[model samples]
Target: MSNLNKLDFSALEVFGRNYLKWVQDVKLHLIVKNLHPAIEDKMDNLVGEAKKANAMIFIRRHIHDALQTEYLANEDPRALWVALVDRFDHQKDIFLLEARHDWQYLCFQDVKSVNEYNSKVC
Candidate 1:
């Protein structure tokens, strides 16, 4: 078995169900390896190629096979990173909208205002 098969976190799903955590893991790993520039910057010819390759491998290693196939044409790590973000980042916004609703109903800050107004009138 390959050492790459074992990961500290779960692989990113094809549908990006685990994308939020997956992205964080990927970023942390890349940063630790000093390969973050591969995804976040446009590189010069020499150093860029090597770093970009390593970053691509790490990112691809943690993703599902279907995602690998989906982004097969993306040779540059930066391009792949942006593509994945564009595809999955919206999930966060959607999640936040739902969470906002859940929290809004559970919040009692408005209750304090209501009680204060009642005390003043009564």
Candidate 2:
């Protein structure tokens, strides 16, 4: 398996998006949803373990460290995935405030410098 990129806490949003794409690509997205039924009378425990292992392999050192002990103790991939999202998704509020601050400060100084002003806005 190719190495999945590490996610530093600050890059959670980007990481979450990329992680979803990666899980889907690997056909393991359903595992993160906590929905894995037994296959052909086989035990679901094996499938669950496989998914957990797959998730553990993708998690890098830093992000793994951010998890709570309870979450780390859980062998379920859905638990880990939910914990990560819950912890990091709170940053969206900070991002929104920053964007609003930037918008409030945005200005067009001079009509003569429209190109420069447009570049800054972009």
Candidate 3:
């Protein structure tokens, strides 16, 4: 059986435009690799140094080069995960604000199709 995991999405960008989705994707990847315990709450057990290194490698591989450089000193996957969350989690609020503003100005006639308009509303 093939052991390689398929990358179903792009790497986490520097600007964090896809931060939420990237987080979700990373969580799924970690779970699949049986490395999620390294980043979960109460990291008392279920994580050894080798497991942490492997999880860190997986995370570093899926992040942008700039992000990799920015977090170069984070040897622990749990620390790296928390650092990323602190930095990019605010983007969610910003995105929600923008979407809400756009929604207020949305017009039915301005959209070409319901699906297109619905996509925006979503």
Best candidate, TM-score-wise? Answer: 1
Q: What clash pairs does model 2 have?
A: none
Worst 10 residues of 2 by lDDT: 33-42
What stretches of model 2 exceed 4 Å from their correct place? 1-48, 60-70, 108-122
For model 1, give the 10-residue run with minimal summed lDDT.
39-48
lDDT of 1 by residue, 26-82 (tens): 999888999987887544634568898999998888889998999999998889999
Which scores better on TM-score, 1 or 2?
Answer: 1
Per-residue alpha-carbon lDDT of model 3 for 1-122, expressed as tens digits? 45465455678999888889999999998899899999998846768888898999889888899999999999989899999999999988898999988875676668898898899879
lDDT of 2 by residue, 3-120 (tens): 4453423222334544433334323433443443321134445555665565554442334243434456866555655566565556567767988888755555343477877787
Q: Tell me the alpha-carbon RMSD of every candidate.
A: 4.0, 9.1, 6.5
**Which is better, 1 or 2, measured by lDDT?**
1
| Lowest lDDT 10-residue stretch of candidate 3 | 1-10
The TM-score-based order of candidates, best leading, equals 1, 3, 2
lDDT of candidate model 3 versus the reference: 0.88
Alpha carbon lDDT of each predicted model = 0.85, 0.48, 0.88
User: Each prediction's TM-score against the native?
Assistant: 0.80, 0.44, 0.74
Off by over 4 Å in 1: 42-47, 108-122
TM-score of model 2 (CA atoms): 0.44
Q: What is the lDDT of residue 55 in candidate 1?
A: 90
How many clashes show up in model 2? 0
